[model samples]
Target: MRGTALGAGVLFAGGLGGGWALYTKLSDNITADDAAAAELARYERERPTALVRGAQNILVIGSDTRAGDGNRRYGKDSGTERSDTTILLHLAADRRSATAVSLPRDLMVHVPGCLQSDGHRGEPSFTLFNSAFEVGGSACTVRTVEKLTDIRVDHYVVVDFSGFKDMIDAIDGVQVCLKKPIDDKAAKLRLPAGRVTLDGEQALGYVRARKSLGDGSDTGRMDRQQRFLGALVSKVQSSDVLLNPAKLYPLLDAATSALTTDPELASLRGLYQLVRGVRAIPTEHVQFLTVPREPYVYDSNRDQLVAGRADALFSLLRADRPVTVTKKNTSPGDSASPAFHGNTAAEDSCT
Candidate 1:
């Protein structure tokens, strides 16, 4: 999701006057996931149909692969990776609002059979949601998400750790207010309490640091990630960045270089069209929330959907209906209410 916003920033910079050569270079940076598209084409009949004509649902995946150049510091390259973070972004038909729903990697869900890298079809199984990525990469992850939520996915984007860090550096830094100090050696982060600005490396650790933070649960990490993203979006939309071409150029480069998307969004023009629709959406209209879930019945570490609540949230998104969310937590069994626990981009994290 952060990559999507940063990529859109490129269009604004390009329009200012980089000429054809620079535009070509930036556009070429985006990798087209033709393999995933081909795999998805095989299951077109099984995929859900798009309900709203102008609405869009994009799956933004943060890949935790340690094989890359700058990523070796995180861990050893095990020749495999999973979806470290996954968010389903829904843009309203009117383009007045957007909702980002985070899906926990530990959530237990039914994964549909998918074609594996070994050139064989793997049998369907019930397992951790992130397992889909480990088995078949983006194609399998998309199929699993589609199966989990009946909403159609129009496109998908994969971003990596190095790219994420580069984007933060490009934007200077994102400001965050911490109530307590943090010193997570595992995440390579050490920061004092209160308001502070985080560089690319620190921002990565801030969002990824689980054990040294509140509750030490993925849920807490997800909430912190949402808040940090909101802060990033707010910073990008500020006049200081948008009004300056020098600032926009680095952001443009970092964003395009970071993404791997489906064929439709693999080019500058396609991404431009997407940005044009969403660039004007007000900050207050941007909502962020996690899917309703509870600890898995069989295992305390795993998660399961909160029965009727999860289905209700999915239903609203499928129809492109408005989803209202509050900051306060709601009962897991409360399905009659329309509002869920969440926060908007307009809210100040420091407050």
Candidate 2:
């Protein structure tokens, strides 16, 4: 319900940008519309898999790049940017349900060799999962994920800091809950414990603030980000944002402006079709969960996917089956594996 436009661009913009596909056609030369259409056509040619019974796997990468306006304030672009956030979004074949699996950046994984943006290719190696993004942008990241999960990714969308901030401001603000006071200088966030509505800048800081938030852990920060996203979805779907062209236009422009996508997903037509399918699912059917993982045995700072559990989760997605997330503790002394967990689109923001 809340993400139809911006939940990695597949969730919230379901009804708003449907008109984009009518504007252009694919051609050999790369014009604004031409470039996008050609890109999508190229992807169609190179991808190894066909559509799976109507199911779609979209990789949404939230890049923490300081290359654009309002973003450079964060820091200078030191050449390449790491994926600040990554979600493997799975839309069910029937368009009746959607599941977004968050992949932790700190996880240790095999980064396959890939062609870089600069026309050079890098070799595969064992490194942080986010390193794939740094080495070859989204393609490399997608390759690594496919190799790791054995599930084909149909499309991808990369959004930078400025875009995320602009979208929030376009929508007014998003509501969030804070259990205690927080003042993180590094993230530029300062807030008191309570329910509050956050504007663009504050929302970014809220999601990015780690040192001053719960347990000072990435997992805790991710939970907050998930809840904030849930609230944003609620705001968009419940309001007349999609129906009101005046309000929808800015939101659409902000979202589209911030995205770098796969060829097929690069055009308005491709995205319109995607949104149409996603809109068929009710918010209650959409679910969110993190990939099951634990600290690497050799290094507590880095993470390694829990072999059996991780494979089971990936397999369910590969088969387009419903993922069962129980609220029961299956491990001892592991806060990461909570006894009660997981969130769906229908969750109350206050909870």
lDDT of 2 by residue, 1-351 (tens): 323543324333343465333133211111132332343344444444534678889888889888878888888879779999898999889888888888888999998777666777688799999998888777778877877888888777888898888888888887777777777788788887788889999999888777677787778777777777777766777546765656665676676677777666665556767767666576677777788889989999888998877877777788887775442243322343322245676776455
Q: What's the distance in Å from true for residue 273, model 1?
A: 0.9
> Model 1: residues >4 Å from true position, as ranges?
1-18, 329-334
Give the candidate number with the greatest TM-score.
1
Q: What residue runs in model 2 are displaced by over 4 Å at the alpha carbon?
A: 1-51, 326-340
Q: After superposition, how far is residue 51 of candidate 2 from its true place, in Å?
A: 7.8
TM-score of each: 0.95, 0.84
Q: lDDT at 246 for candidate 2? A: 62
TM-score of 1: 0.95
- What is the model-wide C-alpha lDDT for candidate 2? 0.72
Give me the overall lDDT of model 1. 0.86
